[model samples]
Target: MSRSLRRGALAATAIVFSIAALSACGAGNDAQTLGVRPDNAAVSVDDVKIQNAVVITQPTPGVKGPAVVSATVFNNGRQAQTLDAITLPGTSATVKLKPAEGTGPITVPAGGSVVIGGEGNATAVIENGTEAAKNGDAQKVVFKLSRTGDVALEAFVVRGSGYYKGFGPSEVPAPPSATPTASATPGGEHGAEHGGESSPSGEASHASGH
Candidate 1:
């Protein structure tokens, strides 16, 4: 065999080995399993990943309100898992979670994911934040997983207005306006009776005067 041929063959073999190694290491693998967060705002641990975790602010400071946390939890493990709670470190905000019906914690199906902060299902509610979490700020929080350990990451603070309209702490939503109902006149039947009785009295007075 020629030296050039041997060198070529060696190069080919090295390339093959490198490809195999990357495959074993899961090149371009799913974010959940690899614990490789997609965005800088994302974090994962033990196949349980939370992406885009954020706190929706109450817009104005000194209002003293709770901010809501929104994130998409992905469980890449073979078994199902639950999210027990999430805590914001170094902040006055308390965590309030609305668990899935019949499940105490947020449940993630095997190989499936669940998205929080939407209008539908229960989500993490950050209660009693005085002035810590402000608009355009970032807060670090730790997620307590049922199977996996704590996964901590920074969550951005967004004002719940304009693009983030309609998101805030749970409040007594303003009651819908009552639609105008078709009914009688402004004074009802009493005014009509009064007008009729007044007309007769006026006629009697006119006759008495005549």
Candidate 2:
């Protein structure tokens, strides 16, 4: 084989290898982008993992409303862990936890998980002080655990609609009913009677003058 032909063959092999390398890199990038992250927030503290942490609020425009915390608490330890309370930063809102059974702290069993704000599950409500967070906003939520301590993360705020229709706080105060205004004419019958009496009085006065 000629030296020039040998050099050309080596160049062709190098091009093929370069193309293979690029293809591998592209596949790696595609694999990395395969899965979508959860829309809600999540945090792991030691053996405790808080997944799908979200705040569902019933807020109106410019008015704060009641809210609830929804998440799944997973305990990977050997013993059960209790969720004490959840708190919001920079707000006076108080978080009240309602266990699934009895009036006790929410407990996640060992090597198991507890769902919050789910059907027939534990509930964490933000009572009294309303949540001012609007839909699609991120609010900082601090989860207090028995052993893991406090794990704070910015959870996404969603409205109590669609997928979260029944996830709102149990005790959302109803808006004040508008007081009915006193009608200018109290009753049609009363106004008619007054008109009739006034007309008769005017007619009698005119007859007397005549």
Candidate 3:
């Protein structure tokens, strides 16, 4: 090769090596150097089971009253669900859906869900039932709809009964059967008597030990 051409090639090779070394060093020093993009990060909402939805209060739009609702979200999947945000469901000048505090991007653990209550404290709002009634015993809560997989899609909210109540609001406590209780005997006593063995406490004894 010509003298000038060889010198140019050598200089280019040195520049490439220096760039590679800088890249490696920077990557090792900080996580930002890993070339991660927040916009491309995976976020999903799945296994969304609505539990105990209720309307605690109503909203006030100008002279019109407000429509408030509440419900619990159950996560029945193995992965965590991050609720990005919620938008009002229907178009009613008099109606509005309110977003609760810390409503955006909530993390629900696997095999678990979060309970959303208080009509006035909803993450988003939607129109339910007829406009004349101006009351949503139940409305469609469409999720922002994103998943760990590529592309953020749309998700629909299923309709179910027993999710709404009147102005009176009460927490839906767990079922009584879920509570733990002590074992009992058939005779209403503490222990069971089988084959004259009496209780395990050895309270009753036979004369011959038989």
Residue 95 Cα positional deviation in candidate 3, in Å, after optimal superposition: 11
For all the candidates, what are their Cα RMSDs to the real structure? 20.7, 20.0, 21.7
Alpha-carbon lDDT, every model: 0.62, 0.68, 0.37
Question: Order the candidates by TM-score, highest first — what do you get?
Answer: 2, 1, 3
lDDT by residue (93-122, candidate 3, tens digit) is 132323344434555457765544333333
The model with the greater TM-score, 1 or 3, is 1
lDDT score, candidate 3: 0.37
lDDT of 1 by residue, 87-160 (tens): 88886667887753544777878998876664554567676654557666678888888889799988778765
lDDT of 2 at 180: 25
Models sorted by lDDT, best on top = 2, 1, 3
| Model 3 alpha-carbon drift over 4 Å, by segment | 1-46, 54-66, 88-104, 119-133, 136-138, 148-210
Error of 3 at 166 (Å): 9.9
Query: Judged by lDDT against the true structure, how good is candidate 1?
Result: 0.62
